[model samples]
Target chain A: MDAALKKNDKQLTVAEKTLIDTNLLKRISNGDQDAFSELYINYQPRLIKYCSRILKNDVALAADIVDEAMIEIWRSAGSFSGRSQPSTWIHSIARFRLIGYLRKNKELLQDESSEWLNFKDDALLPDEEIVLSERNRDLIKNIGKLSDKHKEVIELVYFRELSIKEIALMLDISENTVKTRMFYARNHLKNILSSLDLTDFG
Target chain B: MNKKQLKKRIPIEALKLLPWYATGWLSPQERGYIQKVLSQYPDFRSLLDAERKMINVVREDKSILDKSCLDATEIRLNKVLEQLSSTNEKNKKASKGVNQGVLVYLSNLVSSCSPKMQYAVIAAVTTVTIALSFAFVAPLLDENNVYYPATSGVKKSNNNLTTLLVGLNIEPTDPRLLKILDENNAKIDAIPSKSGMHHLTLSVKLNATQIKSLLKTLRDNKALFWFAGEEF
Candidate 1:
């Protein structure tokens, strides 16, 4: 029995980890600060990573966004339904907060100051600098060659890590429409990436 | 079936299936079907390879937030909680003071009303004074203005001329029909009326027979209204 339990534990996936964290969220909902802290520790890194992509690497701004979203999570944790997975719920919260932050600081997101700051920070990383390195830039340039709808699906799915169902919800489109977009986006991306030298990342 | 037969069976747009295939979202049965098709056609295999590379590039792009920022976020959240608690405490004390003041004022005001009943006796005299003023002025108002219904008949003037006037509750966008002393014509005028209706007065030079023909035309167009006259 012990050996069987050890084998099952060793095979635990990301989804399993998320399910365990959600139980912690249930306790946090009842005003358990310790459970809330545990939930935060489990999910904060991924949430921050997601925010960084959306906010484009202003650590302070990303921190502020994560702070606001987590605080909202703390306040509204009692309202979480098990209808969706906990990660999905938390992701929705993060996306909502990020959009709110962008709306409030519309000028900052648009102006050269944010981009300039990100560009300056690019030199700090040596191995895994920014994902949009020169090779990725070439890939993006070729992706720009695709139709707008095709490019949108690729960005939302791969870059944002949104599931097809989530993408359908976000875009207010049908699941078939999301699938169709993904189908075209993948094909177009394939065509573009084929022309470039992407073997280095591989 | 041969590779050519398989290629012909699958639509070219099925090439769009490559992304879902790369994501491993395709069901086992569907994957087997695709594999069998690909096996017979080796040329499409390179497209599948390219699809795989694209997925890799997308997944490898890491999220921008790091651990230190999340720690800082926790500290900021605690500060917000502290501020909220302090504000609630301050509000509680302020509200207690406001409730006491309001209660004391209401009690004093309620007690003062009973003894002041003699001063309240003047209200009846004030009402009678208002009633007398209204009775004296009402007839003068009636003499200055005449009330006309939406539909009325034409009245003859003192000079034996027949006149028809149309009254509208709304401003009429259409032209008006008028007959005066055996002649028939229509005019659109901006004349105002006393009782919130738009008025048009028509004086006819023609006889009543011609006036009837003009009135028929106005009636067909749903524009005719009966005339109202007061001998001033």
Candidate 2:
């Protein structure tokens, strides 16, 4: 489980959190500032991380993008038809903005620098676990080096835990394309990991 | 292929969905398909395990922003909130002006009439206004005025109690939910249905204003109640 899940365990189950998010969106539609604030607090960390990954780990720019997306979310909350999960709806808004930002600044998408490779060893682990964590960090660095198309599919699946259908809708691609990209992305990662002598990793 | 054959072999397209299946994020149909395959082909579990391992590694990378970026985000959010507040204020003001303008326009039109015509117009306006007011506002003040479930078809009976059908967001076992019910002088009349609908009975008869207040309280606690409506 991710940090968000861990946090939710202390307060709400996943189902409860989803219900609360839906209710918050309804309240936000009615000009409820408190509801909006609560939602912002809940989603800010998640959105910032998502946008950062897409924007070549530009955390500052990602924050600005998330803020822009949030304002849009506030204005458009009333029009949201509740057909999808609120998380999906919110992520779609952020993804739309992030894609638009990339369109205007194409160079940012092309810059695959190693500056995004920062990692911290925060947890105490056995020697084997330590080696695994080190290998994991390297894997993350390699993921950063993937092409934008391949990287996005991997990130959406492994990091965000979004359904393939949700990702296809967000990326405006066919589900087949999503699956193909995911396959190629995994193959690419596997090749790189093997090349790095990190064969213990899947 | 037969069903058994299909379960025995994993298609490339289905293999591509292994990551999501490992994450437990696939739709029920997809998940069921994958689960069926995994159950039949035990050795294929290795593929699923591999995907799970990769997921763990990816998630281990906590893509958290630095404190500086988080603080900046907070500042930006506050600015956006201020902008929204101003826009809301502007909308309220514009609506208020429109209302005032309509009243002023009507007053001027009535004033331009002759004295007899003006008196007749005034009498007519007053009669229409009063009739409209009674039509719109009488129910608001009526003691028996309460929300009715559209599907229930039950009307208010002559009693000192009202039933409210509520959908709870919190678990039914939560003590805080009981406390909320107690605060409203309500009790669970029926255990929650599978869909989470709870029938709560207000112990005392409440007037329209009280019901409105109670509904407002229930609606405001969005984290607790998904929905609340009286069963009159």
| C-alpha lDDT values of all predictions | 0.52, 0.65
Q: Give the poorly placed runs of model 2, Cα more than 4 Å off.
A: A1-12, A102-202, B1-75, B115-232
Worst 10 residues of 2 chain B by lDDT: B62-71
Write candidate 1's Cα lDDT for A63-136 as tens digits: 55766787777766766666555666675566556644654555434433323322213322222222223243
RMSD of 1: 29.4
Model 1 backbone overlap count: 14
lDDT per residue for candidate 1 within B1-232, as digits (tens), equals 6543544455554454556566666657667766875786675675577567667765674221111222343565576567545765797889988998877775565556675653453454457667865664443343335432222221222243344433332345533333321243334346633322233344436565765665555434433432222111
lDDT per residue for candidate 2 within A1-202, as digits (tens), equals 6987766663445455568888998898887988998778666655666677655455546777888889878877875666555776776677657655754554453423112211111221122222333354243333334567777788788778888889989999998888888886775565444444444443
- Which 10-residue window in model 2 chain A sums to the lowest lDDT? A113-122
Inter-residue clash pairs, candidate 2: none
TM-scores of chain B alone in all candidate structures, in the order given: 0.22, 0.35
Instruction: List TM-score per model, in order.
Output: 0.30, 0.35
Chain A only TM-scores, each candidate in turn? 0.48, 0.50
